[model samples]
Target chain A: MSIIIRGARLIDPGQQLDQVTDLHIKNGNIEAIGDLTGLNAASEINAKGMILSPSFVDILTYLRDLNQIQKGTIVSETQAAASAGFTQLCASPDTQPCSDAGSVISMVNNKVVSAGFCDLLPVAALTKELKGTQLSNMEALARAGCIGFSNASYDISDNNILLRCYEYAATFGLKVFVQAQDQQLGDGHMHAGATATRMGLDGIPVIAETLAISRHLLLMQHTGVSGHFNQLTSAKGVNLIRQAKAQGMNITADVGVAHLCFTDTAIDGYRSQYHVQPPLREETDRKALLAGIKDGTIDAICSAHQPHESAAKCAPFAATATGMAIYDMLIPLIQGLVDAGDLTWALAIQALSYNSAAIAVGKTPKLSVGEEANLTLIDTSHYWTLNSSSQLSHGTNQALANQNLKARVKLTVKRGLVSYQM
Target chain B: MHNLAELQLTKNGELRHFLTPEGLDRLMLERILDTADSFVVVGNQEVKKVPLLRGRTVVNLFFENSTRTRSTFELAAKRLSADVLTLDIKTSATSKGESLLDTLQNLRAMHSDMFVVRHGDSGAAHFIAEQVTPDVAIINAGDGRHAHPTQAMLDMLTIRRHKGKFEPLSVAIVGDILHSRVARDQIHALKTLGCTDIRLVGPNTLMPQGIDSMGATTHNNMESGIDGADVVIMLRLQTERMASAFLPSAGEYFRLYGLTTERLAQAKPDAIVMHPGPINRGIEIESAVADGPQSMILNQVGYGIALRMAVMSMAMSGQMQQRQAQALVSSSLKGEAQP
Candidate 1:
């Protein structure tokens, strides 16, 4: 049995689809990219005025499984992920017991595979429980099929330690993602800018992020092993990543929607919900990020969906939580980008669907005759108000709460199977 | 040791216990200075050693964790007298379950004499002073970021050795005056010694909310902060203490509010640098100037120990004498010694 999504504006940046077309799905694979009206399938989805595109992939996610619990379990996470159009999510190792080994990866993978919804690719931890003193069994984790590994949620202070992790990652054929920050310089809890000054908030100087990134990039050059930079939040950050890409180094970078849109100025009303590490930068940095995205410098955009209980971010500016659940907010954020002229439908596809799938499977996503039919159906132009009622994640920290956003998922098909419907 | 003043007793014509800077008068501070002079010279020897604190017990009861303060106290205690015992009870146990009174009671039962007390909550020293039954002395390292009396004394010693007397000199405490225990102690000590025209400098965020009541003028700019002052005291920014308060980034604070060489030039040519250690380098000040010719930072560290030793001995001996009289009366009333 196969599925056919009909009468949709199927935009595949990889295949350069801008006009309305019909897509054919058979046995969980893309059977046809042209007019599929003449072909017959087990199920047909009327996607009029909706986008029949590949489901978005996220390179950062948390999926833990030790003795009992997995991160929301693969079924639960994938259900939530599908509702938000995420087909593949890289499971981070920063879990309950902390994913520091191959058994950890295999344990998580088995649980996700058994749950069966979306692919839960494990991102292994770089150190022994990320202790920063010893290395994890990179070889064993690679054998267990971890796409990438990280120290998770922070940067290691020792340059030698990081360099070794990078070198070890290279041997395992996995890219290392550094959470960029100068540890000693991170004594403060807010962005190092005017808002922190006026509010009397402790600050993590933007230099801290850039300083770590610069060192990591330099080390990458020396080690000749490419590294990935995540959640860049400053104008200096924009230039560093742009320069690194221009220099032809094998470095890839991404930013959260918060950094792209929010700034330290948001703390004007002391909206503690907007608090984040690498603090939301200034308008100047936001503009720089927009420009970076316009170019090929910023390869992807991620949710950076860190879920902390309300008690964590419930405090005043100095004591509030550092992150919010953002996975569901990604589509609306990109929709805003499209409306603002900073992004095109084509570029948005490249950053979200194509690039994400590429990162996961180590290859680009194209709407060819034989590519896998992992497609998400959404009305890209539909305007709807977002609320916590629709989100499936355990956390409700989305900053875009109650905000009007474009697009709502209609159907989520993974591997030619109807995974979800709304 | 219910009262700090009662801790001292004249034993063979020597004062004991160092508890207050007010009583550690000029002669006593000067003697401690001389003692420190010998230690400073001895520090250059093959091994820094003396049998001074050989058998006597010295306990570092810091309820607060200060890298510089603890290390210097340890160094000073080692050089001066008997055994040095550092009991850092800043962890969960001291803050909650085991009360400060209980810990002091347990330690006193062991026959200790000196306690260099540094605590986050105010009145820790006064509370310990009230509960101590042994012939013990309490040295206020710092409390509630309120007053670090020994630091003030050492600063005074440094100033006196450089500027001669405190009666007519102008000294300004720059950087964070708001949450600095050092700033408060410095102000009290300077005011006591008769220093006129003290200026409190830095951003309003860093300066004490109402320092004018203390007879000190407030200045926001580096120029006004140091303007014409005989000695400028730089208070290291207490970044760790910025939890409840949002005091901006160290970079912005440093650029707009830090003390630089040019800023220091607005003061007297003989202006000396003084900071409680482990400088935030680029945050609170510039390195070129902190390590430059005008810095008396190392001298402050050296003087801190001697000042502490003097106060400890004075307080301890006072308590010994008071407790001895009580003991004498109790024995007489009991009609006979146990034997």
Candidate 2:
């Protein structure tokens, strides 16, 4: 419907729409974002003192594909992404029969072809089969419409493989996504320290992330390639990412919504659902990630969705499978940022929207008349958990069950169509 | 009496320090097993104290900890009517150069009779036994991974009671055969009892070199390694054991070496399963097999106490005289034996 959201607090980080003004939308495009109290359209969305900004974007998501345990193909995640207000996402190539080729990229892209819910992009594995031994066919994958190159497990045990990956992906002019974690240190489950101690559980120390990030940043500089560090956990890691950004390195980074929301302390008594790879870190590290998000060191927030069945998380902490929280973790997680006052409404919207759109389409979304209908219309006050029911992907692995969440999407519009309308 | 000073332990009323089962005699293991059998019922009793060591201090000066072993020792000592004191070396002054002898001297000053010793050095119990100047008793809880004498004795007791004899036994040890102190101790004890055929089986990464010196044939293949073995002793795989040597993945480890039903069938039809505890379910052995009808790992935990009682009583036998004398003097100071 042609509509004008009247007297709303429009926040356009690209245009610096921090001031309170009414936003006008017609034909599913942002027509004008001026003070229009008596603006005329088919419908007037009373967005007074509410955020009228572009929809959120999560650069990383572990979407489950059926035949290919690699990309985002699960029916559940697609619906949940729309509900959680993620319009665009990049799925890692780390699956069972990994996405290392153009065929695999085509496989994911084709499956998500009908997925008008969110803009799902396939992230092909940087190395062949995620063995960290050889580089995947970058040219072939790019032809298959793969947007990025990344090691799904991002396990760069051999420094030569890493250097070559950067060098090869650099040759393609395509950025690589790296879930960089040092293989040697930080081998434990939770974030190391008093939390792990109290839970009698082992933890991967924060130094592992910082060390891994530093190594990747150095590798990027060495190869002069663009790579994004997936899920920057520690403050030190944030500082390191910030340093790389300041050094004019073409390195972008993201954090999972869970990492932004929870701390390693959530692992008290071995709560399995809080268990994610490159795990939820310490409070200081969580704060650092928040600060990174706030200061733009962390470029985007992704829901590192991993839907494990019941038997997966039932074993002992060390023995259990590492991955949980797909459908119901994002909104509350972001809401937690707003609640704790670490995230501003404007900055969060920028990280969620234009920055992600910039990365996906390789440019920022402007307030001009003819912009593509890739927009998100969210009300500040809708609340519900779709995945918490039997339809939930939890299968009883919901870690943030009682956590308070606020702020939700009323409708997510992609290409001038209601991709996910609640 | 020649080695009376060395007798810091007593089992089945014998006087001797339980340093090595080799010179301690093959019959000593049987005697310990018998004494432990007598105390097994005591463990089940609500009033477990038998007054065998009442008013006596039993110090557990463990230099290395196996929570499974330490707990059993504590339970055994408490059941024997002794006041048990556990000293963990990791938290003590030994890390600061408090010599083992000096620590022993301090405990001796406190009138401790039995030293349930567990030291990281294999011969540490033997070292302490050699230096026991007077009537104190030494029960080797475990010393390094070299030997857990009581563990060996108890394991023997469990074997003899279950299988009736070691002479006709064919035992197999799987995983960590190289560095396991329990494997060494069990091997020696089994050898003393004339266990004719013993197989050492595990990946080359885990099997100790020169295991042929222990008179056990090393088998790289788990299928062939456990062939016709009467008892299977599965050791825990310590990831710490991995050096620069690249071991296979946990999945690979399980596939190649884990004691699944298929692998377990390689042993004798009636052979039982034994693990020293804290088993890695999928890595070294499967869950169904570990908790299966034939697994005695939990029983081994229970039998540890009886074996420890046998060793402690035997080691402390020589001290009975001095202890009785002190008791008489104290009673006399209380104006005659009141009863």
Candidate 3:
């Protein structure tokens, strides 16, 4: 269907365009930009005070569709993603059978095609079944449409095997995604600090992240591989990444949006919803992460959208599951950051759209003519509470539920199709 | 959601759930101590049963193996005239793959009034109190490294019986403060009970980070930690500490921080030594010191029965009062609707 978004503040970081303009989309591609008021279409959106940007790309997310359909399905999660203004998701490989084999990749692709809410890029496992012992068939899996390779929170204890995996991925010119964490030191549930001590819960020291980042930096440099760090949660970790970048390492990194908004204090009273992997760090670290984003040291911010069933988060803090169902509240949270003046609108859009797309698929999302119409219109002044009735994700494990938030996704056009609308 | 402290109290500040000592104020804590003092008389009587919870059912939900603690709670419930059911959860439905919530729900179906939970995970009792069955009273027996309220109360009772007042006392807690739920609860209770001179004695490795901010001072040397102290409470060093690299050896620990007669002499002449026992004779304390005249170790265990009875009855009464208030409110609403 053809459509027109009229008189909206169109901010496209990829094309370096920011202006109140009208854009025309015809047959799933941008037909024209700059005053399309005279153009007629099948549908029209009067986005007068809204901000329209390229639809977000989440480089790390868990669909949990394979054997854990009880947690989430491809259709449900993609619909949630669409509502959150994300039109592309890089699905992590920690599935039931894992995305190690070419068949798993094809199965995921088939499911995504059938679902058709958004594009799905599967990240194949770096090791067979993610056991960290044997390497997976990376060359074959890459050819089967895997976007990248990752071990997904599982640690490769043997340095030699990890080095070999990096070297092999480098040979195929494939990007390797690393979730840096020292397995032993990351045994605790939350960040190591005074708060964790006060609450009597075990703490995961900051070194768990920095130590892993340091080791991975050395390995990436040694193997000459394209590397990307996922979910950095500490100040030292950000500094290390900055230093590595300054030393001319061709690498990029993304921080989880939750880490930017919360700290170890959020886990007070043992609220299981705040329990996350690479658990939230201190305030200084959160500020450092935001600074890293503002100064362009951190390239992107991901929803890190791990959706789980209610039962997963119902237990005591440590025994409960480790993630928040973030898709339904992702945009409002980023908007909250912008509203609080911690993030500029342009930088937020660039990190969520342009930088994420470039890192994940090596393509920049643009609002120029002839580009695909993957964009969302957001009502920045709109306010709403995220109760169960308003939540769209199948997972009810949202930590931000029942909280008032500014901004809402008013319209999302994916490849000229009305993927979502309020 | 209400915190553990908030969940433990009613609107007017009555005890509802005894989850932790962290939230109980001086008045509430003193009430517990006073109630236990009255129950001490009941313990001395021939027929030691109270009619406070006569028809109530108290379930002893032990997820971890704790023979001593389970028996104390079971006996306390029985003494309160409540029907008691002890479930060794490790060998029960938990092992059969039933979740904690599912098991608690099934038990709640049987109309139990309270759950005395001893779980290995921190905040387990709070989860039960808040999520599983809000109507049922939850008495935390020992939840991970979080709290052991009844134990702390019993220790407080022992201290009060020996020494006059908490304000005039210098209390020293020794060994394994990092991993002891008892230490955490004791710190909170001691602080609330007006004990300002609280010293935590152990190696830096055994001390929890930021515990000093909780109104307790940390000392690596036992001599300085116990100097001028009126009460010395030693925590048991778990055998797993060695396997986990928390210590070099039991002998080494004894040599460094153990409570020997010589170390005991560092405190006041009449200072009392206490251990939440199952104590290691040579590891955390010397046998001579543990069995000495100034040792209040046995008294702490003896006070456990009365202390548990006090908290159980108080929390049950709080729940009953809340339910009755709710009933009155709903009945009044219904009456108004009839008009």
Instruction: List fnat per candidate, in order.
Output: 0.00, 0.00, 0.60
Which regions of candidate 3 fall more than 4 Å away from where they truly are?
Answer: B91-97, B337-339
lDDT of 2 at B102: 61
- Least lDDT summed over 10 consecutive residues: which range in candidate 3 chain A? A191-200
Segments of candidate 1 deviating more than 4 angstroms? A38-40, A64-74, B1-174, B177-339
**Per-candidate DockQ vs. reference:** 0.02, 0.02, 0.53
Tens-digit lDDT string for candidate 2 (A1-422): 67676766667789876666666666777677677765577766676545666766768776666563332245567666776667677887876568887766666666665766776677888888888888788888887777888887557788887788888888878888888788877676777664453233445777777788888888888888877777777888889889889988887888877787787767643456777788887777888888888788888877777776655654335545677655565665666678778887777778877777677658777655677555555566655544445233433466756544456665566666567755
Residue A375, model 3, lDDT: 91
Report the C-alpha lDDT of model 3 over B175-197, residue by residue, as the tens digit: 99999999988988999999889
Model 1 CAPRI rating: incorrect
Query: Judged by DockQ, which candidate is best?
Result: 3
Prediction 3: B-chain TM-score: 0.96
* lDDT-superior candidate, 2 or 3: 3
lDDT of 1 by residue, B1-339 (tens): 022233333444345544344333445555555555445566567866666556668888886677888887888778665688998886353233135656777888888877877776443454455434435766777766445777887888788888887888988888887667677667656776777788888776665434566567888777767788889788777676466454667777788767788887887898888887778888877898889889998888777766655555455555566668778889898877665
| TM-scores of chain B, in order | 0.83, 0.86, 0.96
